[model samples]
Target: MPCYLGIDVGTSAVKALLVDEEQRTMADATIPLETSRPQDLWSEQDPETWWAAVQTAVERLCIRAPAAFSGIEGIGLSGQMHGAVLLDERGQPLRPAILWNDGRSFQEAEELRRFHPELSRTMGVIPMPGFTAPKLLWLARHEPETFRAMRMVLSPKDFIRLKLTGVCITEMSDAAGTWWLDEAARDWSDEALAATGLDRLRMPELIEGSAPSGMVRPEIARAWGLRGDVTVSGGAGDAAAGAVGLGAIDDGSAFISLGTSGQLFVTTHRFSPAPETLVHSFCHALPGRWFQMAAMLNGASCLAWAAGLLKSEVPGLLRQTEAAYRGPSPLIFLPYLAGERTPHNNPYARGVFFGLSPETQPVDMIQAVLEGVAFSFADAKACLVQAGTQLSYAGLIGGGSRSAFWAQIFANVLNIPLSRYEGSETGPAFGAARLARLAATGEAPETVCSAPAVIETIEPQPRLVDRYGPRVDAFRRLYRALEPEFRNAPTGW
Candidate 1:
């Protein structure tokens, strides 16, 4: 049977997935990666490491399942969005890629907001420190020589795609996060690029996620033990592709992702900019579909940190908190480990635990952490609703969604029905594989991107509703009360 391969160049690792026409996983492999933080609030990674990880992942996948890897007909690329990978004319990176989590551009982001007062309105996103535009401005100011040497800029996955096909191209979904795209028009905005000292020539050619962007080079194909004619789809940003994996294409369809960074994503058919609230409005992986998203910079990573702190595994921690979830704990956690994105674009915001007392136990803290994340997603839902996007239900995906305890809290806190689909746990890699199928077969996306079988539906429980309702108010108020202090907090606190 013919198969498709989807590779996601994520922040912490590169994931390679192989799937057949019916969306059955044939083989999957992941290669670990690391980020360099030479300075405070700055994140960088070598683009060469990303390409090397991709190669290692693909090689392992082929070794694991040679039959499926040999039958692969098309390739799709997905990755962490908003990363700035500057390259020279020779197609070599001039400097380490500035990552999405990097905060060295916070001042530049504020400067852009002032210089281009209408930027949020035009770009449908507030220029946050995590965006690509401000990162470029930072480079131009701090590393002028390297900046002048930059002949092209690409997102993380596009850098890998270029290595594979010798083509530099990006899709609407990823481009939308770059602070350059005119999301409503589904193309790069001249004004936005000019503000960042970039022009159209430095930007990658735009394409829809499902469209054929290029083909694998002969050498890459031969080295990877694949066909030379493998088609390449213009894959999506990780969130958009995750939405596609959940089949959240129809208007008002939403999904709550609990990956390294959490996001509450709602699909929209029309352009709806909520920049005032720092909500992300971007193009969908599928053409003609747009989405409004509220992102939380901290997600499952928080739990991982907590697990490490408590000297226990995540599963054991959840089990220990079972009793604590029977009622709401007075302790409230702010899940802003990496600062925040939605509703507040405060990069300086630090994680805090409010209402902590002498009686608080580890179990209580764990429960509070889970509830805090749920409340954060609830805030995103409120922002979407306030912006006039009505959500009836949302699909739940990502690593943390594997925990029944957390999934239950998300459904009750958001007060919406949550559906868990089969195979969605694979997230963006699965979606990219489907996009690969679309590129290779020329099939309608509706036919190829069908939602997987729904295995369970979680509705809000009255007890959970009553318990978390008032706590949600406290969660919001605490952030507001502390916002000023957060702004005034000393550096490196």
Candidate 2:
């Protein structure tokens, strides 16, 4: 039986998945990765760690399913988007890979927004510190030596592709996040690159997400004990890859991705730029498709942090919160642990717990955190609507999809049905495998990208929806009231 491999270089972990021609997953392995924070608002990871983790994950999957692994014919790459990996002359990393969540480039992003205001529509969205271009600007100013020595720039997964294929190439979806890609044209913009003192030469070649970039190196194939020349497909950024995995390819197909960070992704048949709303409009993994997304820096990770602070496990806290659930928590939380995106593009925004009282219990705080995340999704839904895409329903995927309680909360908060599919949590990697199949077999994506079976659908409870109306309004008011303070506050505060 022929098999395909999908490897996702995610922030918290690298996941490797192997699937047979029948589309059944045979083996999966996840290897944890570490991020470094030498200073506040900075997140970096060693590119070498990603390479090592990929090897380990693939080795583990091979060991788990030797027969299936040996039949691997194609490989797909997927990972976190907007990470800036600077390479030196010998393709050596000049510095740690600055991640998507890093906020050190806020001022640079602001400068770009002011000077290149016209570029927003072409680039998909207003420049943010989290985007790759602003990171380059920040480096050019503070670490000019490193910037001058830079030979190339690659996103997180493409960096892994460099090791696998001995070629530096990226797909449209990932490239769209770089603040360099012309979204409507689905190609890199020379003018945009020049904004950061870069040219096309320093950038990777572009391809459609399912197109083959190059064959895996012979040494890499032999070391992994593969059967033939493994073709590596240009997969996608994690968000688009997740959309592919969920089979959300048609116009207006939408989903909610609640991982370490969250995104409200709506597929479009054409490039629909919504720069004013701060919603990302970019090319989809499949050809002739695009998507509008509202990205939030905080997601399920906020729950994990709350759990740690409350000295409990996530499962335990969720269970307690669910059991003690009432109409709504009086308290409200701003899930801005790493600042925010979408509706509010404030990187300086900090997390705040309001309405805290001596009468508040741990369960109330837990419920508030969950509701805060739910409210954040509400903002996402509103922004997508403002961008002219009304969502009828949304598929739920990523680590947070495991919680039925949270799914119901999102449903009530958004007042729309939330659908959860079988194996939704395996989103990016599974989607990558599908892209691999497309690359290797030259198969049509419609047959190959069929939506998975829906396991459950949570409908909005009318009473709960009505109750959340006031709370959501209050959430918006609090953010608007606090916006000026956040902008004026000192960074370290």
Candidate 3:
């Protein structure tokens, strides 16, 4: 009867899920979150808003299933990766947390890479504007006073853990993306800290994803109508957590996450560093596990953008695009609305609707947008394959996975089977819940982390694959041709 609560502190929302020992969902709740962009290339959110959102989300869950909430025995945390939440001595946030998509730290990233030439090898990634270390470096350079006052730095989810358990702790998977953790050693690297002008003193306690970090505060337990013995598990980064949710933890196990940002996540047994190719190699939520991820800053968000531009609901857009799903559309969308991460790593990149003509219809535009996102994932898959990560099939999870058309397109573009599992739509929150079940029952992850029953398997249609092959090629060439223009263009452009 014991249930677990998994909370995912996402970029645009806070999601809470309750699952029993058998991994069956008992209840779930979500609270929408808003990010602030005070300047170009900047994305931030008040850490306190995350705290409040968690409380509100949990309160709603309790209302839906009071008995299940009362039986909650453990908590797991998953969140947007690489976010920088600076806390003072009293554990209060010094400023708004910089998100994973924030690009203001590009200069700092370059400077850090220059100072630590071996950084890519050490962190298993090319230092980009979004990672946590660069954000810290940016703070040191531009906000020295605040940086000096910083007592701790935590990711978005760990910030919530601080509020829940009155402890400051982070796990390996999330830490791996910080560009400070040694992925091979599964610990914070002193050399990385030195390069960023940060010391181990400011870092939180490091634990593995499955390890118990702390116990819930008595007050929080009572307020949320939960048992006093609820333990907290070291959750994971959003992608790793989503992989965990899908039970994609073994070698060769991979998944495509189409959330606010997209990631082609492939699990690896060894510490695989693909820095030269811009592939992200990092630890998985579980111990002795590693994953390589190629992230795209824009994912399902592109569909949202299109919806806003066309003044249509997402469901309606999907409905309209059904007829154009496999049809030819001369238009191609770049899906660089928030810039790009994988392959290009160009923060200045802008979205483009190339090949548009007077005959183009709204449905053609929608089809192009979806195809563009799919092509971007195809690019990430190519990098992973080049890095020697062999993947025959992958699970699909996230808000975009609800679209069968999108799933089919991904399968065709990637030329592999894409499985959609029952309850996979919950994504990271459910993965966190599974981790919570592990912590609560001391169950072997193999027993508890198994993939849920697949509801459908999207196999690549040969004709569609052939159709997309040339278009995917064109997608790559288009980006290469536009790179120089993006670099030279003014900020206003």
Candidate 4:
């Protein structure tokens, strides 16, 4: 049986999966890497670290199944989007990559908005600090020597693709988030390049995500115990890949992913962001399609933080909370631990806990976190509805989706049904494998994805929906009231 290799370069780790043509998993390996934060609001990682992680994962996978490596038919890669990786003339990294979570480029992003008012008018969104173009501009202004020596620019996964295939290339879905591509034209935008003072020539060749870029290099093949000529396909951004994995290809279908961050994505045939820039518009993994995405910077991270504080008593706390709650609690939480992305792109926003009284208990805190995340999603859903996209049901995935309690909370808060799939991996690694299979055999992504059985469907209780309605209205008002304060707050407040 022919096999394929799928590599996902995630924020905290690199995951590799080996699967047969039928998309059955054969072996898997993961390598964790450290993210550096030398200063406030900065995140970076070494490009070499990604390559090392890939090498280690491939070596381990080969040890588990020698035949899987020998018969590898193709490879696909998925990774964190919007990171800026620069290469010098010799294709060596000029400096550590500015990660997607980094917020040092706020000034540059502001300048971009001033220079291109048409961006909001045409694309229906404004450039933000977390995007690649502003990061590149930040480097250009702060580190002139490094910027002068730059020969090529790529995203995180593109760096690995270069090491494997000796080619520097990227896909449209990833490029769309770079602030360098025309979303409608589906190519590099000369106007954007001129405004950013970047030469289009420095950009890599763009290709569709499912198209093969090149074959594996002989040296890399030998090092990883794989055939030299294995095809390497161009992969996509993580959100797009995750959507593909969950079978969210058709229009009107939605998927909500809650990991370190949260995203509410709806597939659409048109390319348009909300008029207020509440969501992002980008190409999907499926060719000739697009999606509207609303991202929340701190979704599961807040819950994890609360859980850590409670430690061994987490289950007990949850159970106690279940015992005490006669109905939805009166407290509300603003889950802006890392600031927010969609609706309000305010980096200065801080997490807020309102209606806290002496009577509040640990269980109430846990419930607040759940309700806070659900409230954030309600904001995103409102944006989608205002933009004329209708979503009656949504597929839930990721670590947060594992909780039946949280799933029901989301269903109740959103007043919609939550669907889940059985035998599915949580991240984009599985999506990359499916893409690899489709690339190699000309099979359709929809066909393979449709076979997964529905594991469970969580329906919202009427009482909870009625209770959440007024609270969601109040949540919207609170953000607006605090907007000015958030902007003026001290750094890291």
Candidate 5:
């Protein structure tokens, strides 16, 4: 049986998976990469590091099962979205790749709103500093030498695609996050480019997410022990791929991913942002489809922080504290450890622990983290509702879903059941593999989603529903009350 290789360049690591046409995993490998924090509130990584990690992962996957490489029919790349990777005239990285989590361009983003109010109005959303366009503007202003030498701009995944096929290309799903895409038209927005003072000519050729870009280069093919003729498909952003992996492609079906960051994704046929600009509107992995997404800057990271403070891991700690967390804790944690993105877009926001006293124990901290993340999800869900997407329930994925306790907490707080898949929690790499299959076979994305197994369903407890209803309302108000403070606060990473 022919297999497809899916490469997912994530924030912390590069993951590669070999999957057969029927979606059976043959082998997988992950290589860790380091991210740099040069200053508080800034995040960056060398693009060369990502390439190295990808190369290592591909080689490892082949070693795990050499036969898998022979059956490899195609390759696809998915990655963290919204990062800016500038390449010079000679195709060398101009500087460290500004990451999706970086917040150094807020002042620049503000200038965009001031100078391009009309463009913002038409786009239906204002640019955040963490977005690609603002980062590019920052580079243009601060690094004139590098800016002058720039020949092409691409996201992290696009850079990898270039390494694989020697072609400069990007897909709509990733492009939609760049603030240059006209979400409605599914193409680069001329008005946005003119308003932002960016050169549209420098952008990579836009293609459908499933379109085949080119074959893998012979040198990389030989190094990784793969066929030189393996077709490379245009993969999508991580969130879109995650949705595909979870089989959340139909309207009314939603996918909630809780990784380092958290996002609530609602599939939609039309392009629309929430009236408050709390959620992002982007093209979906499915060609010509769109989605509205709300992101939380810190989700599982909050729990991870608490675990680090206690010098423990979340899985083991949660297992010990699960039975003890019966009701809400007095301690409330604001999970803005790295500031916030959705609903506020405030880069100066900092995490806070309110109501902490001598009585607050490790279990209390763990409970606070879980509740805080759930509260944020409630806020995101409200944005979806405001946009007229009535999502009654959501499919859950990621490390957060492994815990039955956290899943129940989320269900109770959101007041909706959580649906889960049975097999391995395939992340974006699995989704990319499915996309490659669709490209090769001409099968509809929805058709491939058939017979996805549901492992469990978590329903909200009726008794906790009334209790959490007011708690969620209070969570929303707390953010509003702290909005001014967050805007004026000193930077804290």
Candidate 6:
């Protein structure tokens, strides 16, 4: 039986999974990654570290299931989107890759939007600081030397692909987030590229997520003990991969992703642009499909930060908070630890606890953090609705989806049923494996990309929804009140 390997170069870690033809995950491994914040509102990482982590992850998986690993016939790649990986003529990184959560390019993004307001409808998103084009523009101004030396730009996963196959390519889902892809055309937009001082030559070849981009280099194949050069599929960005994993390919199929960053994504059959509401209209991993997404800058990262500050493990802290939960916590947290996206699009906004007092307990803090993240999703839902996308129900995927308590809070906060599936935390990796299968066997996507077995459908309890209703109002009011403050924040922060 043939096996396929899927790797996700995530913001927090590199995860690899080996799956057989029967859709059984044979082995899995993960290697943690770190981000460097050299200055305020900036997040970056050395592109080489991603490639190193990928190698280690695959090595661990190979050790765990050598039989299955040796039978691997295809490889797929997925990763966080909107990262700017500038490369020299030798395909060497010029500077640290600016991440999706980084906000140092806010001015550049604003400038781009100001000059080319009309492009948003075709580009599918208002050029935000988090997008790649703005980051490149920032570099061109602040680090002109590095920008001049840059010969190519690749997304994070495609950087790893460069190492794997000595080839450069990116799929539509990931490219769509770059603010340079023409979503309606499903191709590069020269007009948009010109705004960033780039052209088609700087971009990698664009392909659909399930299409074959290249083969694993023979040296890599030999090291991995593969039978031959494995076919490498052009996998998706994390969001689209998660959607594919959940089989959210049809019109109006919706899901929420709670990874390092968060997203409320809805699949659509047509390319419907909705930039007025700050909702992202981007291409889906599959061809001839698009999605509207409200992307949040912070998500499970808030929980991680809280856990670290409290010097506690996440699981234990969550258990404590759930046990102590009655209604809402005594505090309302703004989950803008790394600023916010979606409805606000405010990069200067920082985390705040509005109701902390002498009576505040540790568990109360944790609960507030969880509630704050849920409330942020509520903001995302509101944006999607404003963009004319309705969410009667949605699937939940990513590292945060493993928390039953968190999922329940989301269900109540959003007032919609959420489907949870087994191994949902690795949805992108599994989805990549599905794409690998399609590439290796020439299988029809519909047959290979079926939804996995769902463990439960979390429904909104009326009592909980009613309890959260007033608090949601307060949350919105708090953000509105603080918007001016965030804008005028002291220079140090």
Best by lDDT: 2
lDDT of 2 by residue, 302-338 (tens): 9988999988999988898999997789999999988
Q: Cα deviation of 437 in candidate 3 (Å)?
A: 1.4
Q: Per-residue lDDT of 104-206 in model 3, one digit per residue for the tens?
A: 9998888877878787887999899999999998999899999999999999999999999999999999999899999898889998998888889999999
Q: Which ten residues in a row have the lowest lDDT in candidate 2?
A: 484-493
lDDT of 5 by residue, 1-493 (tens): 8899888888878888898877888899888888898888789999999999988887788788888767898887899899989898878898999988888899988888788766553454678877888887888788888877888889999899999889999988888888888877778888777655676788999888777878889998887777768888888898888877777777656878887788898888777765356678788878767888898878777888899999998888898778787787666778888778887788788887777888788888888889988988888888777877777888887667777889999999998898876643556888888777776666777776542577888999989887888777777777788878876766543
Which is the winner by TM-score between candidate 1 and candidate 2?
Answer: 2
Clash pairs detected, candidate 3: none
TM-score for every candidate vs. truth? 0.97, 0.98, 0.98, 0.93, 0.96, 0.99
lDDT of each: 0.88, 0.93, 0.90, 0.82, 0.81, 0.92
lDDT-better candidate, 1 vs 5: 1
- Clash counts per candidate, in order, are 0, 0, 0, 0, 0, 0
Q: Which regions of candidate 6 are displaced past 4 Å? A: 491-493
* Model 3 stretches astray by more than 4 angstroms: none
Q: What is the lDDT of candidate 2?
A: 0.93
lDDT of 3: 0.90
List, residue by residue over 111-194, the lDDT tens digit for candidate 1. 999989897877887899999999999999999999999999999999989999999999999999999999999989999999
> What are the per-residue Cα lDDT tens digits for candidate 6 across 1-493?
7999999999999999999989899999999999999898999999999989998998899899999998999999999999999999999999899999999999999999999999999999799999999999999899999999998999999998899899999999999999999999999999999999999998999999999999988898888788766999999999999888888888998989999999999999999898989999999998889999999999999999999999999999999999888987769999998988788888899999898788888899999899999999998898888888888999999999999999999999999999998889998999888888887888877898888789899999999999998998999899999989987887556
Q: What is the lDDT of residue 259 in candidate 3?
A: 92
In candidate 5, which residue pairs get closer than 3 Å at backbone N, Cα or C atoms, i.e. clash? none
| lDDT ranking from best candidate downward | 2, 6, 3, 1, 4, 5
> Which of the predicted structures, 3 or 5, would earn the higher lDDT when compared with the native?
3
Model 4 sits at a Cα RMSD from the real structure of 2.2
Model 1, CA-based lDDT: 0.88
